[model samples]
Target: MEALNKSFFLFLASRPSLDRFAKRWGSKFGADKIVGGETFEHAVPLIQNLNSQGLRVTVDHLGEFVASEAEARERTLECLQSIRMISAHDLNSQLSLKVTSLGLDINPELVWENMIQIMDEAVKHDVFVTIDMEDSSRTQATLDLYKALKKKYNNIGTVIQSYLYRSDQDLDDLNEVKPNLRLVKGAYKESAKVAFPDKSDVDHNLKLLIKKHLLNGNYTAIASHDDAIIQYTKELVREHGIAKDQFEFQMLYGMRSERQLELLAEGYTVRVYMPYGNDWYGYFMRRLAERPANIAFALNGLFKK
Candidate 1:
């Protein structure tokens, strides 16, 4: 399964055609199963439903790397409008954005401008914004923007991937500001030179990072489904005397329903990352890559018909 998982990641990075298969499956399953939407009008009902279930949500815009400043600015506005809908609906949801999607690749100034706009709007709505970490190539730039924005905005946060060797240092630097962090085991195609290639190493880092956050940070979000990791985190929280609401446990909506609900029922703050958008291929493929069992289940569902 490990070899197959690695091969699937390589295939996703190199073979464009495999995306077609992912797209077909995504179309059948529908976008709401993956991401929110390009517009809040389409995402509000799902967001409201999750909020009703005692779960908080983080909305992601889902596109990345616009080549022109104008395009990026438009996406930024779309995100702002989404925030307005969240406020209107009175939902406990926050916006999660990718800097690349806001034009980081175009010009740093454009990225900063768009970020400032979104952060300002988020503050107006009392909504928080989480800057998602992308590939290693963009990590430094993302961290820089996050730190700068954190200095000016009252409700801005960032994500860190434990799969990278540098994340320990990133956590230490972020400690100076005591920023809110969402820690994930990374979900990108990365090389061994920069990212840990072994699953055990990644899992180890995840546990270590979680322990550090519970012991030292103001607030942290543990975002993973590995049962062992989840159990260890529960133990660490107890050992450190961290209150249930001091941190949150986040999981992808469809990946681990039972575990997420169990955590919530056990009095821990839980958030479901509800992704919905037209571009479901990339998102769905990553889900399959994360666990071959998901792919097998998907394939079996198709064959049964």
Candidate 2:
């Protein structure tokens, strides 16, 4: 059953046509429960609502892996506008984006150019942009893009997947810059050669990365839904006398709402990673792949009495 769930969700993540169909006609399946909506205009209120609850937000547009420069530019422009709007609202929201969404696959140079323009816009608004780390294939380019841009702009940040085998060293190499990192338990399908295949190993690595960042005094966002990880982090930092401002916790938009609010109430900053856009298929499938129980959530909607 575990293998079946893994394979089934991965199959969905790999199917773009099915994703498109679901995006167009599958609202009843609980996509909105996770995704913000179809546009920036639609996502603002959602972000505002979370902010009202004392939770910060990192808004992401639901698209990645563009096949053409035109599509990549289109996504890039949307992100630039998002930064402007986020600033104008004075809302407690930042921006996150995928490298592949900016044409990394088509051409790394083009991706870098587009990313620079977006970062330029982010700086004007004083809004930080986080370059989301994709799968292993593009991790090098993602790091390269981040290293290149961090030298040019101080307002930029990027994610580091804890599942990768080299993450410990990656963090060390990036320590000189005091990298602002969002440490995620990686959602992509990865090979054992390059990644920690065991969940236990990934969890350990996640905690290790968190500890290193805090020890180095770098601002880190611990993105996870696991109770043990969160509690362990809290205890670790408490034992080390780490201030609340030193690090923050991040959760996806639709998961663990009570915990997000509870963390905020405890005076810890919690950022909600909220995604919205017409191209939500890929994002939704990836979510399902990461948490197979999400498939059951969708099925419950379909089979509700």
- Best by the lDDT measure: 2
TM-score of each: 0.93, 0.96
How far residue 260's Cα lies from its native spot in candidate 1, in Å, is 1.5
What C-alpha lDDT do the candidate models reach, one value each?
0.81, 0.87
- Candidate 2, residue 276: CA error in Å? 0.5
Q: Which lDDT value does model 1 have at 191?
A: 85
Residue pairs clashing in model 1 are 34-275, 35-275, 35-276, 36-275, 36-276
lDDT of 2 by residue, 104-130 (tens): 999878998998899889888889889
Runs of candidate 2 exceeding 4 Å displacement? none
Instruction: Compute the lDDT of residue 220 as modeled in candidate 1.
Output: 88
